[model samples]
Target: MSADRRRILRTTAQLAALTAAGPLLAACGQEAATAGGTAAAAGSGPPHPHASPGTPTVLTPNRIPSATPSSTPGGSASGSPPALPPLAASTPPEVVTGPRDRPQIALTFHGQGDPKLATALLEAAEQHGAQVTVLVVGSWLDQQPQMARRILDGGHELGNHTLSHLDISSMSGDQAYAEIAGCADRLRTLTGSIGRWFRPSAAQYATAEVKAQARRAGYEHCLSYDLDPRDYADPGAEVVQRRILGGIKPGSIVALHMGHQGTVDALPAVLEALQQRGLRAVTASQLCS
Candidate 1:
């Protein structure tokens, strides 16, 4: 194989290691993507050939190769779709390819009201020189305006996680609209600009009703996770790190809880491991490009 192809293969191997270790605890969350099925972009790097592993770039994902139906029994009597060409060098960054060859992962935090934990997460990000995004509850902002302000002042991105966090899908039309729009309003007032993104509670978006609600509320897109650290459930630090490192792909929006202690414990390793892999940690919006 050419050197570029070899690098792609090595990268694919790393992504496989992540998956074998399990994903970031997204039990049933819909895959988060731009309208065009793309991952966000953060920075620039080389164009490697289509290899598998490490983490797939969300900005430009290579669909896992599918099996061909045979001419024999139990196969589609019809012919198969043509084999997908291998990923090309110089694919567009906005296309949501998996895992960056450059060191970078966007660290996402959920919940509000706990300034200590919030500060700790931010401090960790700063200590490691990683970019961070904090998704704050509207009420959380009310209780912790200083924390919210600190996040923005610290150069982190602050996003909306909805007011009251009622499951948008289960809510009535007006209620869903209120939940999303209310939060956006609060965030805009708190941070000046409107929130650039919206991530649903539990990473769930059950219907078009909720999707429309978010969009109408002025969100660019609903945020979902490709890797879930399961920090919310209080997984051990080691477990969280293992799951994230094993499962994360490039352009993956990793979900962790700002409300939980395990995530706080795990943050350092997560940052360290990312650095060791030459991945730079950034905010969700920056990754979205």
Candidate 2:
């Protein structure tokens, strides 16, 4: 063949080769992306003190097919936690617990106190492949705005615990409404929507009127626990663990608190005990579902 013809033939062959490899290269790129996404989703830190404090990736229910969509409002994505959707219908505005038929429990935290201790407890649960719920005081969220996102990012749930962590049950209706609504507004601004669950401050159970106010504020249910280890008293970790383990049963909701070193110390053992008993520690949403 003439030199010009040969050069043209070589160029044509190169073009064909490039065209054929394009799909394979594209496929490779896609695979890599998928793998990374999965790791980011699953590897959202050990929920320990060492977890990435800067916020981790958010995975929608679609990313986790086994996960039912948030029974309440708000979801998350990308950098900041994204509220999933507006509340279609109010969640049942009644007291609830995980069903007794299941061998699962919810380890719920009162969201306040030391950020580091809270982080430690969360990390311990995550290390054991458990997910817990944190009902945060609005004021606490204000001091640690990143914590709202951090809680959700750790494959956990974050909800309202009143704005000032005051005695909502004792307040007048209008006063109670402000406390609920105010905290809710903080959650909305930080994480896209007011979280699903609300727990009254200074009281384990909500009064009839407080429930009404919470419903008005948009929470479907006010959370209550079946067990209290009294970790809030800063009781030693052993006592906290004993109290919880003693009362733990299928579908039990254990009221725990953040910012206590004892609770943090007790959590890992409690998780282990649950695991050995063939019980799983999960978020309240997961437990209820």
Candidate 3:
């Protein structure tokens, strides 16, 4: 063969060999790229879409199927809230207590002019198993020494109601002090024991000065009431009784005038009402002290 023909035949054979190997090499390259892509997607041996930078996914132990939703960074579903502790046992609320645990109620009489009625009240109280506190006017005590002594001797408490039952609020502070102190002094002298309880006339209007003066004159406190029968105005026995029974409570101080017949009439029912509620009627001193 000639040298040029021999070279041409050699080139043609080389071209055919190249064409046959092209498809095989392309398929091998494609297979290698696909394998690399799969490894990257699985987040193994390379960074991938499934992987977050600098974050470690720690598998929790004993996780339930329900717990999977809470595993997300900002997931709403979560473990149960912490439980609240039980409340401790508490004491029942009290209406209120006095110096003594036993319930006491006061029956205070306003005026002091009638000694015969006062003695009758004291006797009635004794009969009904109740202690009494007599608020005496200064002149009344002076005028009725025998009756005053009887009340003192009978072991009843004495309270000053003012010298003339004057409206202390209408007077100057000095006058108010004198009216209270004068009566208190007479009461102390006659009874031979100082009184600490005072009830203003009509539970009348007064300033702090009256209270201050009473305190300065060795009085402890004023006696007032949660229940008022208004027996003094002679509203009638039934009305007074209803008012008292409806308003009465434990540790309440009841006010009624000894001078009124209505009070005397209402006393028996009032006592009955108190007894029904398991309360014992007592003097103001007993209530306070």
Best by lDDT: 2
Alpha carbon RMSD to native, model 3: 38.9
Candidate 1 wrong stretches, greater than 4 Å: 1-103
> Model 3: how far is 132 from its true place, Å?
1.9
Candidate 2, residue 152: how far the Cα is off, in Å: 0.5
List ranges where model 2 is wrong by over 4 Å.
1-92
**Candidate closer to the true structure by lDDT (higher is better), 1 or 3:** 1
Query: What is the C-alpha lDDT profile of model 2 across 1-289, one tens digit per residue?
Result: 8999999999999999999999999999999999988976664422321122222122222332122223222334443553433332433555456778888988888887777888788778888999898988775665566677777877888888876666666688888888788778777777767888999877878999989999999987888988887887877999999999998999888888888899999989998999999999888777755
lDDT for each residue of candidate 3 in 1-289, tens digit (9 for 90 to 100) = 9999999999999999999999999999999999968844553221121122232222121211111212323222333221222211321111122343567777766645355666676666766777766777664554554555565444566777776665665566677677777776665555454565676653443357777767776764666556666676788889998998888776677666766666777777777778788888876656654
Candidate 2: clashing residue pairs, number: 8
* CA lDDT, candidate 2, residue 270: 90
Q: Each prediction's Cα lDDT score?
A: 0.60, 0.75, 0.60
lDDT of 3 at 252: 73
Model 2: residue 272 alpha-carbon error in angstroms: 0.5
Which regions of candidate 3 deviate over 4 angstroms?
1-102, 204-206
Instruction: Mark the 10 consecutive residues where model 1 has the least summed lDDT.
Output: 56-65
